[model samples]
Target chain A: SQQGEEDPQALSIQEGENATMNCSYKTSINNLQWYRQNSGRGLVHLILIRSNEREKHSGRLRVTLDTSKKSSSLLITASRAADTASYFCATDARETSYDKVIFGPGTSLSVIP
Target chain B: DARVTQTPRHKVTEMGQEVTMRCQPILGHNTVFWYRQTMMQGLELLAYFRNRAPLDDSGMPKDRFSAEMPDATLATLKIQPSEPRDSAVYFCASGLVRTGRTEAFFGQGTRLTVV
Candidate 1:
């Protein structure tokens, strides 16, 4: 069973705009990581936010975690055509002794130039 | 420069034929995961290994699917008497679990087709 679920199944925006994707999980998590997948390519790790931390930023990507709500959000500032891809959130549940990462369905973002 | 490696970027097999997919996790990484992705079901976790020990494989179908890690570096997922429904992109990912927090690095994935 999938632990995380991404909202806004699909989104479209023009270049220079911002795109936001949200993910919600059922169980408590040790950390939540975001990944991006291009067409026909494997997923690439973007950023990881630990449960203790509330927010983190890397480059133009900003991630916010709200454990109380069991959710996390990924924000891309000044989106470009290259930013078009599927974004997924994976949760490392704290219920397990070992790290077991489960991925969500993902939110497809399309950036039009 | 280190990355997970998967063999046979593409495979085409007949129904009922046994198929095996191989993955070489990155050196020094102890966790390995196998996932199958299709348009309908999206990404489904098949199995995972931690420290070369089978951790959880309940997500996989026990009848035809089997996953194993012979050593720390190599992991394999095999399907006997493959069916058409089993055709999907299989991905192998490896990550180091440090203090219970780590991000995965994925291979290109094997595009399997069972006709």
Candidate 2:
């Protein structure tokens, strides 16, 4: 079963606008990571936020995690046409001995140029 | 740069035929995962291996699917008598699991078409 579920199945916005995607999971997680996939391409790791950490930032990407609510959000500031891709959130369950990462149904984001 | 590598980037086989896919994880990475992506089901975890040993394969169809890690560097997923419904993009990912950090690197998926 998929642990994380991303909201807003699809979103479209202007190039300069900011895009926000949210992911909610059911069980406790050790860490949450976000990934991006361009059309016909493999997924690329964007950023990771550990459960002990509340927020993290990397380049134009900002990620926030709330362990109590079992939710995480990815914010892309000043979105560009290059940002047009599917964004996925994955969770590493704390219950598993190994890092069994479960990915969620992604949010398809289209940054219109 | 080190990355997971998948062979046969595009595969088209007839229905009821056997199909085999291979993945080579990065050196020293302990975890390997296989996923299938389709329009209906976004990404399904078929199976995974830790330290060259299978940890879980419940997500795969035991009748037609089998996954194995022959060695620490090689992982193979095989489907016998593949049906049209088995047609989807298969992805291989490798990651290192430590105390606090986990990140996976994906390979360009193999787009399978079982006609």
Q: Which candidate is the best by lDDT?
A: 1
Question: B1-115, model 1: which lDDT tens digit per residue?
Answer: 9999999899999999999999999999989999999988888889989898889998899999999999988999999989999999999999998986978999999999999
TM-score (second chain) of model 2: 0.97
Cα TM-score per model: 0.98, 0.98
Give model 1's TM-score for chain A to 2 decimal places. 0.99
What's the distance in Å from true for residue B77, model 2?
Answer: 0.4
Off by over 4 Å in 1: none
**Taking the tens digit of each residue's C-alpha lDDT, what string does model 2 give over B1-115?**
9989998899999999999999999999998999999988998898988888999888899999999999988999999999999999999999998886779999998999999
Lowest lDDT sum, 10 consecutive residues, model 2 chain A, at A92-101
List-wise, what DockQ does each model earn?
A: 0.81, 0.83
lDDT of 1 by residue, A30-108 (tens): 9999999998999999999999999999999999999999999999999999999999999988988878889999999
Write model 2 residue lDDT over A1-113, tens digit each, in one string.
Answer: 79999988999999999999999999989899999999999999999999999999999999999999999999999999999999999998888777788899999999999
lDDT by candidate, in order shown:
0.94, 0.94
